[model samples]
Target: LEVATPAVRREAKKNRRLKIVGARGNNLKNVTAEIPLGTFTAVTGVSGGGKSTFLIETLFKAASRRIMGSREHPADHDRIEGLEFLDKVIDIDQSPIGRTPRSNPATYTGAFTPIRDWFAGLPESKARGYQPGRFSFNVKGGRCEACQGDGVIKIEMHFLPDVYVTCDVCHGKRYNRETLDVLFKGKSIADVLDMTVEEGVDFFAAVPGVRDKLETLKQVGLGYIHVGQQATTLSGGEAQRIKLAKELSRKATGKTLYILDEPTTGLHFHDVAKLLEVLHELVDQGNTVVVIEHNLEVIKTADWVLDLGPEGGDGGGELVASGTPEDIIREKRSYTGQFLRELLERRPGGKREAAE
Candidate 1:
């Protein structure tokens, strides 16, 4: 079983609802709510429904205070005004970046370090291989001297906005020809990086260490993701999964309190399942995952649901319903309950609704 540290356990033991009385933050109604710990909690509402304001302005604020020493416990006690219950909150939000010629996925999750070191440890490396440091594009030695290992170059566009073109000398390979000649199982470093996570999974399945992590990326609907794809080039959703992969790699000790904001932003219908697996793993490890999501599939999986909208704008912040998916569906007043009910009705013969 994944175990949280004694301190985390103690804090969780004291876990209770977050009380917001007369919250002055944006779009936040005089909200009074309680968010339970240990179980997966999904915060749901319509657009501009104070979801962001509540999670970021309140829970995240409390956690930040504790971490930065800007605030301390025992201020307003526990009923409201941000409490000590939320100590670990990681907010993953949207970012604008698709792909960058100079960047790739390796630099984001920190997986590149060990892989480079692994090659450096090879017998060939000891005989003729350069040090791990030298193999890095960030350094010299085996790097592409012409492009400085970035594989691309920035071009100044005269009489127009600045632009960049692929490096002419390196041909966007980002490695010297000699280094490209070194083969790991008949695949060059550039060749391996050029492969997507799906292809890389089969290619490196027997390589050990790196394979399992790469597989997770593939299962998460990132099969098209290149090993060397720059993070700066990734969509927000892709970057979140990369972050999830790193999070799952940690030894499960339930004390972690991860906060994810609309993690399903860019996913297609099929891709969400893969994301769910990652979240389930974290919860099974004993950590508390709090997500701000509008997706029905996510809220349906919740052990307990916290719906915070009677309506948006000045109407939200008051708790409309809090219970299981079944219970919420029974409540005529719940907005999410009504929407989910419609989904249930559309299915033939009252068939059960599927998780998104």
Candidate 2:
């Protein structure tokens, strides 16, 4: 499909870059790379082509150590520059946000706190003198004591795996009757948690804090997920996107550098489109996003491309091509460009014209 150029491309006058000089990390040769700030740049190549070695082992680790004071050392590299232009760096990976069942999108994104506060402000809560803590399922007061607020009871079986059944007391609602009694628009706290992110977006439209968080979740194509779905149930891509949503909702400093490795893994075509929109919006806000990607849709839309490897492993790690998609496609040696040329040519746009 025809992809629109990012707005950053139109105004890249100063051309500030994050330079990785003389990198020899893992399978990488003594390579040097320049990643432009405030653009969506993709690092692409064959498997084991040192994409990970160059970006993750070298760039991300080095940037983290220098900028955040992290002790993790980067792989062998001569020098890194232009880190001063960034105040923060985030690596959004596909790791679970929490290990326990109590963790969910609402809790991770901090929307649940405001949801509790809003519940506490209700007239029924005020009349009963119920504090915000009373609505918490994690605590004792308003939780279903029968299940210890897990909404389910786990029964141990020797030799057999543990079995869990819904709580008879609260009927898997997590909250006790008193907490459930405090309602907003006829829906209880449990009812709110049961709502999908898209449902919650409309349900809490009048509430700014809650609405904004739900909106971010929806923007990342997580509208179908329950507001309180267990973190353990989420796939890797879903978890990664949730992290992206949380970051998107935060106040942008316009100097944050976001790095992602294969974010499109396990995503549907529609979901990938949504992901791109969010990434480009970050660039529009003057934040730089560098992704190690192989997806054609993602590569086509990137403002810049860094194609590594004429081959994989021992034969790879050199910077085979580095430029716009147009520039990369013209380089005779770039395998990424050979494939990218077909994609860009299939659609009519400036990217396609440049490829021609």
Candidate 3:
């Protein structure tokens, strides 16, 4: 698809592309597309334009099917005609939040276990005859017996949405009255959750793993988040970054493919920089990062662009153009090409930036 642009296409060697052939699903009518990996790449198209269908449901799903290969699966599930190549595709999509104010980052990141163990295994803990499970809300031995460790009391509203009132016993802190009595350097679990990542960094400075994990969250533009904050309270972008941080912490490496859908959807213009850094870091670690994006900033940063449409809906699906920002602008048939060209033409000296 990028045959027209020699300069942009030359970087082809750097990519580990998800090659497709006759991948029939959704609006993609007998479509064949090539998505380059590693370098920041953007797949742009109008809404309902088959962008999600191709990238998320079809290509990424097929790749994952290969990973979860089991005996009970459907025959055609993993097989994609012409889609012969790729290591693994991670669909970094935002999912139903772990609601229930009881759920917090410490629990979600699996950091709470070791932390509780640290305290439980302490000499003081042995003197007090306390076990690590006692610190956990999920366990029987140590949770608040009243609300069962949930920070709130569920008020089943008959004619309205169910409301939650802060647990009168624990007062919005999931810990039981006794658990709350325990302190880690003077901060309670509720206090920790209340403290944003910015605050937690300093608060947990003495701690090892939790502090580092919180630092990663901060680096991913989640400085405003608190370790104890409920997952239900997080914004989409915040949750996405948190999820990204969880993956990044693994020091992920080798031919892995990351397929994210509009990762910058709710982010501010400046916030894109954090995501770009995350993507580039993945590439540096020898992995592939592919994003279905409408944001031009991401599109421009891409080493390759697999722009999907001439138009959206019924008129879409064809691979109108694919290449760098420069090559696309010169392609007459590509709507994105014309759209971008118009923006440049309207700007001073054709110097319009993606953030604009």
* Prediction RMSDs, each to the true structure: 6.7, 3.1, 5.4
Instruction: Report the C-alpha lDDT of model 3 over 1-356, residue by residue, as the tens digit.
Output: 11111123225444345667765565666677676554557788788777877777677666666764522222222345433445456777776347676676767666666667766765556777888877788877666667887777788989998887777776777676566566777766557667887887887687877778777778787787777777777777777777787777776655677888999887876678777777767766766678888776566556677778677788887777777767788888877776666544443332212210
Task: Give the higher-lDDT candidate: 1 or 2.
Answer: 2
Score each candidate by Cα lDDT.
Answer: 0.67, 0.88, 0.68
Please give, for residues 1-356, the per-residue lDDT of candidate 2 as tens digits: 33454333433427578999999989888999899887889999999899988888899999999899998789999999899999998899999999766789999999999999999999999999999999888889998998888777878898997777888998889988888998999999999999999999999999998999999999999999999997877999999999999999999998999999999998888888889989988887789999999998899888789999989989898999999888999999989899889887775554211110
- Using alpha carbons, what is the TM-score of model 3? 0.85
Full-model lDDT, candidate 1: 0.67
Q: TM-score of the candidate numbered 1?
A: 0.82
Clashes of 1: 10
Clashing pairs in 2: none
| Candidates in descending lDDT order | 2, 3, 1
For model 1, the stretches where C-alpha displacement exceeds 4 angstroms are: 1-24, 68-87, 96-102, 157-162, 344-356
- The true-structure Cα RMSD of candidate 2 reads 3.1
User: Can you tell me which runs of candidate 2 are displaced by over 4 Å?
Assistant: 1-15, 154-164, 350-356
